[model samples]
Target: MEKEKVVLAYSGGLDTSVILKWLENTYQYEVIAVCINVGQEEDFDAIQQKALSTGAIKSYVLDVTEEFITDYIYPTLKAGAVYEDDYLLGTSFARPLMAKKLVEIAENEGAVAIAHGATGKGNDQVRFEASVKALNPYIKLIAPWRIWDLKSREDCIEYALKNDIPIPVTKKDIYSRDNNIWHISHEGGNLEDPWNQHDDSIYKLSVSPENAPDTPAYVEIQFETGIPVAVDGVKYSPIELLTVLNEVAGAHGVGIIDIVENRLVGMKSRGVYETPGGTLLFEAHKTLEKLTLDRATMSFKKSVSEKYAQLVYDGLWFTPLKEALDQFVDSTQQCVTGAVKLKLFKGSCSAVASTSPYSLYSEDFATFGEDDVYNQQDAEGFINLFALPLTIRALMNHNKDQKNKTDKKVI
Candidate 1:
């Protein structure tokens, strides 16, 4: 008889590393560690080696950075979906792609179950499990955080030490972090307290705004159908373009947000996010849409954006509603093609100018100077019709008042 195999979503982090060993010990399953890379800055080779050394029967490190950008980030970007008006949905969207790959590996290897280190308290556990169920309804999910006696990071650290497992964090300098190309999110530690101002030492991809340069830097971005294609008139691949923007905007200390957001698990979690490139792209894209998108479309899309963000954040990516919403978003983005000039200074990114061939803003019609397009006299009829309901209500009130006065006088 052979031992049942379980595919583990390995990250070389404290939780997953511990989970890798715990799964083998508890379930007596042959563990297969699958590390899915989504543009996080980590040495995959070392992670694979670590997984193999720590009782994994086999280890796989798959690079899905390009696929992540093309499939997850771009669609979310085009939809203008920002979770809770601050988070760029970096960690949210990446989870599904990673889960998809996990399922694929599990299916290929004929694994009996999939395991993840996501805790019960956070949104990630929901994200990972929801995605797994959506992709493969029958696959068993092994979540140690929900069942195991290890209640806190401290307990997990103690377990790792006893197990002789190499862990990353100490008790003193522990901040729960999720990193990808679009953004890096920091939570836990001092950020757990809402009143504590996060120290400047936490920033990884950018400088603190206080230490940013005095001079503002201007950047030009070109978009086609709502997708960023170039920066400063230089064409680049999606990954290359984002890398370039991240470097430029990061230098100016752009895209740092601190918020106490309500989680799907019915708790509030404080997080600090750094998203320099994503911030620049979003600002530029919005400016272009203002020039190209009509008033009604823009207004309706705002509502759709909120719902879309909620769906993504809640790990409902594979649902029909999200798919339909994507279609609606794609239709609106057809005309969102243009170039925008943005100014970055001290963690602020602002769009200064934009131009589009399909722009609805016509200078000839909007000019203050006298022109053939001017029709000042036409405003009277338009205003009368627009305010007809209000005018009628006022007249009705006046007639009621007059009749009441007459009745009083007659009496």
Candidate 2:
């Protein structure tokens, strides 16, 4: 009898590499490893070779960078979703796309199931499983982290050593990390302690603020429908735009954050993230929205943005509520077409200037100097009506006090 085939979301990392071997050894399943490249700086040829050498029957490396930017990154960008006002949802956004690709490979190869190395305690498990369920409901999921007895990274390394499985990580350098075009996040090891500051060497995408140039750098970003299209007046594709911005902004030490966040699985985890290009893009997009979006729309969108961020962070990306919220977010972006100039200094990005053709700001109505459109006396009527309820309440209180005083005298 032939063994059942399983497509595994392989990243060439310690956990995934171990899981790949374990699946083959234990279940007698032919594992097909699929690696999805979403702009992470990696050698695909080496990764593919490693997968095959580690016992995968076949291996694939799919370049999903363009699709990731256009489909996943842009939609989240338009929604202005930032998890906990700090994380850009980089890992959260990438998981769904990765799972989608895994499903595709499983269908192509007639695989009976798909597998991932996502831990049972983290959000990636939810993201991967939700996406797989949404895309291919019939495909069974094998989550090794939840089922395997290898409880810690130490155990994983020991298992790998025993199996002669080559992994990029060791017990000493056991910081579990996820990297992509948007950002890079570091967790595990010393990061597990909230009191310990993140080591400066852990950051790959951004420079330390202390080591940044004393002088500031100014850059302009142009957007159409909340998507960043240009940097410093040079138009580029979504990926190119991010690439250029990352180079410019990373040099100046623009984006770095350390936070202790609430995991979706009812635990707290400390992580450090570097999101250089994304930080600049988000700041510029917000400035443009300030110019183009009306006051009421902006106010309401603020509330909507919080929920959107939560949904994305919580691994609810494929749900109906997220889709419905995207529709509302898209409607708001129609007028969010503009340019914003920003000054990057140290670790901060400040909006220096912004303008939009659809801007509701009127120079004539807002001018400090005299204008024919304004009548100073007209404010009296407007004020009276606006204060009617307050005035009536005050009068009622005064009358009650007078009646009480008179009744006291009579008594």
Candidate 3:
């Protein structure tokens, strides 16, 4: 009889590399490693070779960068879903796409089980398993960190050394990182301590603000239906546009965030993220929304944005709530078409100018000088009617207080 097969999500990192070897030894199963490239700057050939040498029966590198930007990143960008007012959902958004591809490969290769390197704690496990269950419920999930005795990054390193498995990380530099086209997130090591300041050497995608350029850089971004289409009057594809912005904004140290966030596993984790391109796009999109969307719609959308951020952070991407939220978000983007000029200085991006054909802002009605569009005298009646309840309540309170004073005098 043929041996059972398990497809493992391999990253050629310390944990997953060790898990690849352990799965083969412990279960005596054929371990096929699948590495999905979602714009993480890595050599696919080298990672594939490393996986195969470390006891993987076979290895596959799937390039899904285009799909990642067009489908996952763009939709999240349009929704304005920033997790905890800082994180751009970099790691949160990548998991579902990776899980989707993992299920596809499992079905194609006739594998019975899929495995991941996510620890017992953290949101990645939830994101991975939730996606797998949504796509292929019958497939068994083999999470090594939860089931195996090897605990902590140190234990995994020791296991790798004992088993003669080649590992990429060392004990001294054991920062757990996740990178993509959008951003790079750094956790663990000194970052685990919330009070400790992040060393500047940790940032990979952006420069230190202290070393940023003295002069501010000005750029114009064009958007259509809430999607960024061009930069500095040059039209490019979504991926190309972001790539250019990353270089320009990164030079000025624009998008670096250090925060202690609540993890989905009932613990707090500190992380530093660099998101130059994502930061620029978010600012540009928001500027356009302010011009096109009405006050009421924008206010309601703020509420929706918060819920959307929570859903993405909790790894609930492949659910009905997310889909419904997306529908509502899509409807609001119909008139969000415009161009915004932004000034990028050391660690800050501000809108300098914005214009749109669909803008709700009318200069004629809002002018300080005399204007026929809006009557200045109409404000008195509007204010009186609007404050009727307050006016009546104040009068009633005064009358009661006067009656009390008279009663006290009689006593």
**Model 3 alpha-carbon miss at residue 256, Å:** 0.5
TM per candidate comes to 0.97, 0.96, 0.96
Clashing pairs in 2: none
Residue clash pairs of candidate 3: none
- lDDT for 230 in candidate 3 is 94
> What's model 2's TM-score?
0.96
* lDDT score at residue 53, model 2, on the 0-100 scale: 96
Q: Residue-wise lDDT of candidate 3 within 239-263, one digit each (tens)?
A: 7898999999899999999998999
Give the candidates in order of TM-score, highest first.
1, 3, 2
Question: Would you list the C-alpha lDDT of every candidate in the order shown?
Answer: 0.92, 0.90, 0.92
Best by TM-score: 1
Candidate 3 segments exceeding 4 Å error: 152-154, 168-172
lDDT of 2 by residue, 287-326 (tens): 8888888889999998898999898887787889999999
> How does model 3 fare in lDDT?
0.92
Q: Which residues of candidate 1, in runs, are more than 4 Å off?
A: 168-172
Collision count of model 1: 0
